[model samples]
Target: MHAEVGDTVVVHGRTVGTTDRRGTVVEARGSDGPYLVKFDDGHESLVFPGPDVSVEARA
Candidate 1:
């Protein structure tokens, strides 16, 4: 997977009935690595996303 800074990242809940999380990519680690994201709740994390994650480019 590939993402650029400013892209939107949607992380699906790991369990049923849980709410999904959304964040903006603040830093991308080359072509293969975890991305640094800033969530809407004012938190930041380096996430190695799985198949449940989707990225939307900034238009």
Candidate 2:
């Protein structure tokens, strides 16, 4: 999951009638590219499972 700024993030949701959402990495906060991300809906949060977060590439 090595992602870059502008790269989209996808995760599985927990319930039916709802799907995982996608967000873009807005800033690289760590040594690796996994970064602080912001969704299209204007929501922002840190990706979980630190190592699970990765760089997808530039948009």
The top-ranked prediction according to lDDT is 1
Indicate the residue-level lDDT of 49 in model 2: 32
For each candidate, how many residue pairs have backbone atoms clashing (under 3 Å)? Answer: 0, 8
Clashing pairs in 2: 1-54, 1-55, 2-54, 2-55, 2-56, 3-54, 3-55, 3-56
In the range 1-59, model 1's lDDT, one tens digit per residue, is 88989999999998989998899999988775499999999899998978999898899
In angstroms, the error of model 2 at 13 is 1.1
Model 2: lDDT to the true structure: 0.64
lDDT of each: 0.89, 0.64
Task: Tell how far residue 10 is off in model 1, in angstroms.
Answer: 0.5
Name the regions of candidate 2 deviating beyond 4 angstroms. 31-34, 49-59
Worst 10 residues of 1 by lDDT: 25-34
Question: TM-scores, in order shown?
Answer: 0.90, 0.62
